[model samples]
Target chain A: MEVLDNKITKFREGLAKTNLSFREESLKYAEDTLTELDFPTTRVERWKYTRVAKIANTQFSSRKDVVKQLNLPIQDAYTVVLVNGYFDKELSSKNLPEGVEISATSQSANNLLGKVATIKNEVFTALNTLYATDGVSLRIKAKTIVDKPIQLVHVITGENTIATVRNVLVSERFSEAEVVQVFLSENANASFTNNVSEIIVEEGAKLVLDKLQNESESNFHYSNECVQQASNSNFKINTITLNGGLVRNDLTIDVDGENCETHLNGAYILKGKQHVDNHTVVNHLKPNCHSNEMYKGVMDDQSTGVFNGRILVSKDSQKIEAYQSNGNVLLSDSASINSKPELEIYADNVKCSHGSTTGQLDDEAIYYLRTRGISEKSAKALMVTAFISDVTKRMDNDKVVEYVHNQLHDRFGWDF
Target chain B: MIKITNLHASINGKEILKGLDLEVKAGEVHAIMGPNGAGKSTLASILAGREDYEVTEGSVDFDGVDLLALNTEDRAREGLFLAFQYPVEIPGVSNVNFLRTALNEIREYRGQEQIPAKDFLAMVKEKSKLVELDAGLASRAVNEGFSGGEKKRNEIFQMAMLEPKLAILDETDSGLDIDALRIVSNGVNALKSDNNATIVITHYQRLLDYIVPDFVHVLHDGKIVKTGPKELALELEEKGYDWLK
Candidate 1:
């Protein structure tokens, strides 16, 4: 404990002026919260399957650089470019859409920032809060239904750098918007990316978030997404983790209002020695709310994956319908996965169920494809795409679906 | 186009095909009739390169290429098609898309270009009529929620699309109705030509009535104990296997 405290103190000192700037009050409060927190150990029940020893033992310095090059995959959409934890104006769009705002300046209303994400056992979010600077504050005005998606991309250009980014997305009443957030690295060197996102969907609003994590094999990525959904609102999140050396993602959604709907879907393909852990929580606090969560993983070679999903319905949350399912396919004997889907309901009138399944690629199915003249590689790719299609097809956006499909195919060197 | 010489195969040390030899030529239709546990399916499985069955002796030649040396998919690309007894249900894979992919792969193997979308669709439409496959089934997921008869007919429809040089029907008549059986056999007959052959594997003589075979072989305990003309099927159907032994 003493050694960890000393390391964290030195880490805080190491992050001193490299953040560009943070609101003084927010920084102090975040630091105070950090003092009361610790890196999650095995003792933490929520993080039992994930081992963070290497992360806790390694120290990463901050990086600062101007944006060199960035590509936007989405068309006719506003883009915000953040390079090495700071916003880069040269790479961002000059023309902002009407009724939408993207700014690097901090906002004073911190209602859901620290409320949705649990801080006691989350060191990444706590650290992000303390060192976040130049993060965007995006607001979609009420009754503004944006046809084009808003894209946010972060590119890391540093070696062994710890890049912390914080962003807040708000969709006001009766508004609808699709948002795509991408995390990529230049492969310049090994690095760690810690990202914190807080989303708020007001009454009668709809927000779709697509997060694509396509990092180099040498990088480690940690992301925490906290969502607060209001009455009659619909919120959906699709996470596609295509590649990374080590990755951990935490998504917690609070369905706090009546008649609200939430959808949480994740798909990941891991090969080589890559490791990925996805932990999600959906809390139902009101009546007549619906939430469905599904995650699929395909692991090959000696890679490992972990999925822990928990759905909680409070005592007064009546008539809540919640379902969670996790499916994993192991391609090699050495590949392994730990999946736990749990449902804790205090409401007598709620309908909730959770299931976890793990298996290898179906041999009979492969033979069937082969007998039809499909090669082994093509057949395996087809089966994998089919396995993950359940989650990918849930994506209502065609562009996002195509992007994910391309990534999955390219991972196997299969032609799309 | 296929020749199996003194073939010996086993599964887990138990010999299934013991010293079995057969010769099939282009434009020939051969029916292998057998009783239960007679290695009828094993023969078909081995010919299609199923890894579960290991051949300990002898060899198979497909169009003069050592068939035993090829992989399951390679055998398939080399113009050998096996219509499974039970078609697998592949969810999220449409019938047309899967057929297109398979056809393209086969063409690529044969040094041909991919078929245009319009031509492929037209071919699908024309061949689907051979087995009377519902147009809706071609657009839906492959064999998903299909009836037993529909699955059998779908297999024939696929056979028409691939148009292999050699087609093996492994109990394709089982679980199918009389109408389905007639449609399936007719589809097979329509695809047969001087350049192609068909192997019909069955336990009953009922299917042979629709698609007459030039030669009929009785297999018992992994070896061909009898080889005769189309009349052999009627004899087996009337007298059963007791007299053949």
Candidate 2:
């Protein structure tokens, strides 16, 4: 067999020891789906700007090492720690709220673990489903408000290792909570991470999910998140991609009920031949729903960035309000960005608008600053900061805002 | 405090300032009056070391240094300030923060101590009051959402903070009402000192009523054809530039 097929055969042989009935069923479905789909290339419409040939040709194997002790994210809430995509129970928080449930993948008794994200057409997600051995299954019961933020920290520490994690989160009726998922690595290693998250927000529930991806620059990271919202429920996802070699995020949220709100905001900064892509889909399937998405990027020194926002308002979805915008700045002559904001509306009574803008710093504005005695360097930094201010203001958490702001400042050498 | 001789400049091969000569000493305010397209603002831009204009032939001396060779920020550091005809609106950058940064840049060039936060705040309060700028506007972004009159006042407010040796007000009185013009001119009169100079570029003599100029030069066809005292402004304001043409 070819190496690609051999990797699949090796993956199936490893998954032969699955014990859970639902997971075992999902593994079979994943195996069948993977056979039908291949890793996406640039020819595909949805991934026309991203190239994934290296990821497909690389020799990847599931690798793990028991980390006796590790430092978790500094947070005041329940912490779920994962090393090499396996849940480290000894390192996670033991004490929990009365209605909030957390468990390991092998011992999970939750029925909603693999029930949310059922889209099998995505190859990466199917690969994640077939190879993910352990992850977190969490749910908040009705009317339970978790004051502290539940943080899931994923650490990668190996070379040529492939780690896949599957996270399932279901917030019941009227429940409100905040969750922060972080990806971090200590060294520059050639690794691959395929993470899939399935989230469900039932009637009147509100959930705030934030993702911070700061992996090694030599690694490839891909995440596919699918969320479903019911009537009067709200879901918001804030993603900040700080540093990565080849990163692609595909987040889709289905607004399936009336009077629902969905928001997706992301910001990225890349330099030195780095590549980042952000693709978001906000689907309004019912009447009286609203969706908003904004993504901004700043690339320099031959780096590349792509932002594709697709807002789909179904035929039966009346009185829908949707807005999407993407703005990018290319600081170097060789740096480039491709931004496309697409809106597909079938509803007659919908108000939808989409726009995108890509350009360099305003020369007139730069000259204005220079006449004020500010150096050209400081002036450029200030203008770039101003360019991303609107997107940064969308972040709700102060700590996360400060963290992202400091990262951008430190990365762009705008610390002054 | 500044001298220019036989200054010739152009934009895209179209000459704007042709053989323009001017001289200003300490404690003097000179108003260069002209009609539209007479290159009045072009002269101001060139003096502040704007790059858009190609100085095919000319020279500018600021206090004794070759001002034509300095960069924009370097000219600003050496005490040349140009209040733009259309002040650029920069959102997300606070007015006070920009002023403080500009002040520190000038200070750093002079090898002076950076101002403390407490002193900076005090200076903001006092200088903004001098220009009659609202306390709220001082904390907001630089000229973002500001009215026409407020933007002109902000230009003067920056002038008050920086205390430039040669301040060129490009059309500072264009969009202001009579009352705004009076208040803005009052601020200019208050800042006038023996060691510093001001160049007021205007189209009307109404502003000359408040901040009286020592010399009034008429720039026609890229050259100053007439130079006189303050009364010359009234003559042109009544008869218009057609008489000179």
Candidate 3:
């Protein structure tokens, strides 16, 4: 307790040096939480494969007046940008679709702090809750569908900056919508990002969430996304992480009501010395729920990839069907991958299975293509594209799929 | 157009073809039938330039040039085609795309302009009918989930598309039913001309019944034991390989 108290005192002294707008009580809460809690280490079961202390030990500086100017090349959506964990009202507007409401919640908002108190055991969540200056709160009305997507851009700049952003989304009954959250950082500067996103879907609501992470080479990022679904709701999530320094993403979904359907799909492309870790958990709390998960990774150079997925079907969740798969391709000998796909089913009448495969490009397929007069380089490129096309084509969004394909081409130096 | 002088080949340091000699002229169909361990398929593999098989002592001449000097793709682009005994199943590669690539590669090797897409589609439609292959099947991954007869017909379809000078049908009749055999044989017959040659490697005389060979050679113990006219296939079928052995 004394060691933790000393650490908390040091952290508060460091926090006092930054000119952040926070209430004294919130600052006291942050210090109290830091003193009471211990940072997650390798000894923890969930954090066994990924070590976060490497970043926790580093000192990060917070900059005041570090404004960001974001110009999204992609159009046809409402854009919201956050600079250094602070929501920029000047750059972000409420030009949303009908029946949708978006607003910023400050630390003083009623019930906001208590709503996140349940997740205090999550160190990052507690930290973000205590220090989050401002966050976005979005709500969609019942029986209304939003045609265009809602885009949220989290931009981080300056060196040694530690930032946290929080988001909460609630979908009314039978509402259908899509949201895209993008995390971007400029250049190779040491930084840390801690983010928490919570989503809840009412009965019969359909929601699609796409998370894109494109961070700088010298940053450490940890994100937690929690989604809960009601009866007959449909939920789909597509995560794309490209070129990150040290990134860890935790996606936890609970089908709390009957007859719900969920799809979790992701693709990660890592190069250089980057390391990307994805941990996903899907719990079937009710009967007759279905879930599907597919994650693919392409690791090049000396990069590393880790995928840990778990599906749990409760005792009463009979007739629940869940499938999970993880596939990886290592382009260089120095590249590494650690994948674990697990299923725990307490229900007897459930069809649940999981599979994982890690290997190099198919040599026989490459040789077969080459024997047909195709060049060796072209053959390898075609095989690689075909291997990844299975996951990309499932997106069903032509533009997004094309963007991923182009990113793959840029990574492999292939024209198509 | 093709000559093999004392061609000796081995796989895994075990000799398969020892001092085998054969000549395939233009506008000819030759059938090489042999017992199981007679190195018949090995001869086709060596000719098509499979890397695992080493040519310890051999010289092959194709179109008045050294054939063994070229790599696998170069040999393929130089108008050589080998219909495998068991066609490899390439998942996620469309049959139409594979055929188009092979065709354009051969065209580029010959210094000819590429065939336009419209013409290529027209040619595919025309050749697909020759092998009785459904138009829908051509759009699927190559040889993936294909029936035995469909796989054989697809081989002929590819042969018609590539139109190589020397088409070696390695056991094209092994897995085919009567209907598939007729379609494959008819496709082969239609593709054969005075400018191109075919080498039909089979274990039975059934395939030769439809696409009759001009010459037949019985291979035994990695050497050509007997050379005769097409009627020799029927004779071997009647007496079986025991008499030849």
Candidate 4:
């Protein structure tokens, strides 16, 4: 393998030096893959709608520091804080439950890190694999039902910086837990975050994860979530992105066993020159499995949104039911969306469906509301709220929902 | 309570209401009986500030205020309501929630405080009953999946909640059954008062039989061709609109 691209060489040389080390074997694999991979361009099918030239062509510095006063959405949850891609022990919550273990990936001996999230074909995953500073490592013991939610807060600070954060979560057999991962920024500019999360749900285990990305308008965010589910396991993830200059999320779920349930939902609100792209794939390898995915977006000003959802049912995966839908609302003539929902079924006895809709708000509905003494602004707000409520209501966490509503109000002046 | 003079309106450069004039005093119900394409709905729409129509020459006076100058919501805030012929279905927006918003915004426009949650709920309960509307329907999405009769009843239910001074029922009886029409008329009659008036735009005399309009006007060829007592509805019902034309 040879690294010939000068852009890749420049980006690699600009990364902050890492004093922490991980498994030597995994690191070698990542190094080899990184040498063979170049920065993706528009020609790449997966990164077609997303452009990485802004990240690749710029020089970035990595700096770490502890800050005072970290405002969290869920305050009562067991919180783990990471500042500038490094864990800050002084800020994390202490006194975990008996059956739950929460530690930084740099401190934990995690064998499942590179097993689920492959760095074979993806360049960002390889980059995160080689130079990840710190991330969360959460493990739930078998048959243990965690009483409280666990939150991981990743805060990026400073200007012209890059943070590679990698996380691994393992839910043992018959365990149930809820985890929230929030990406926030503090006085940051021209920053980039490359995040990769590897999740494993054992047989009879259930895991629910909520991810909120609210970075600054000048930051770039890219995240990859790789999940594997055993037989009789259930996994659900909700991705809510409120603000960012540029964001791309890649999520893959591999259902390797029978009788598993998987749900993936996302909602994004964009304004200004923001851009958000979400690509998700769900592969069903066994029978008697169910998967449902829905993503909704609202774009205003000159913003753009892209959604690509794929569901693949392998041969002999009988009795598999999969549904995917993407809906978008453009508030301005300059705003736009590109949505494609694809389903591939190799089995004869399977039910798979996909749909995509991109349009403006219902004009008749707006007029109806206006005739009832509601202002045009409020009418649009109400209709947009109703449009995205399908995914937001299914968030199932009132605190998170309230926080999102508050953010909407603060950012866009939408009363709903 | 309201008066319109020489209202000329058009949509897509095609004239709908040409030199149309109407007047409704306090404590009266006027039924507008018209054939198809006679500008009945255009009159109702222009009064409620539907933007699709271009009002070439018109002046609407609502209690000495320029009704035409206000926007749709402002016109609504000024106590003018239009019960649409086809009520829109707004999915996921509950009837009660939107009604509360409309009522509060109207109140705010009138320099009043927000309604208390308890009192608002009580009002919803009372108003829904007047239209014989099911209590569950008030909490459901606005007109979504409602039967035709139920949608008309919901319109009446909204009128009862808002308590407008000049309510224009534009073909509110079009899709209603006999029983539903009676229920809706009864609700409208119960809400009538000396301070408010109603303009009932209908094609039949059955609704007038229940609500008992004070006067009936035959609208034809973009204008009111004739006006008479409530018995005029009976006459028009007996002899078709051809006699007036």
| CA lDDT of each prediction against the hidden true structure | 0.86, 0.85, 0.80, 0.90
What is the Cα-based lDDT of residue A306 in candidate 1? Answer: 92
Native interface contact recovery, all models: 0.70, 0.66, 0.45, 0.75
DockQ of 2: 0.68
Note the residue pairs that clash in candidate 1. none
How good is the docking of model 4, by CAPRI class? Answer: high
TM values, all candidates? 0.95, 0.92, 0.88, 0.98
TM-score of chain A of 1: 0.93
Candidate 3 lDDT at A23 equals 48
Query: By summed lDDT, which 10 consecutive residues of candidate 2 chain A come out lowest?
Result: A1-10
lDDT by residue for model 4 (B1-245), tens: 88889989999999988888889999999999989899898888888888999999978899999998999999999999999999999988989989999999999999999999999999999999999999999999999999999999999999999999999999999978899999999999999999999999999898898889998999998899999999999989999899888
lDDT of 4 by residue, A1-416 (tens): 22337477678895754433456777777777667677887877887888888888878777887778876779889899998889989999988998999988888877777888873568888888877888888899999998888899989888887888889999999999999899999998989898999999999999999999999999999899999999999999999999889999999999999999999999999999999999999999999999999999999999999999989999989999999999999999999998988888999899888889899988999988989999999999888888778898888778888888888899998866
Best by DockQ: 4
User: Lowest-lDDT window of 10 residues in candidate 4 chain B?
Assistant: B41-50
Better of 2 and 3 by DockQ: 2
Off by over 4 Å in 4: A1-5, A16-25
Model 3: how far is B33 from its true place, Å? 2.0
lDDT of 2 by residue, B10-31 (tens): 9999999999999999899999
For each candidate, what's the DockQ?
Answer: 0.77, 0.68, 0.49, 0.83
Model 4 whole-model lDDT (C-alpha atoms): 0.90
lDDT (tens digit, per residue) of candidate 1 on A35-65: 8666666677766767666666677777778
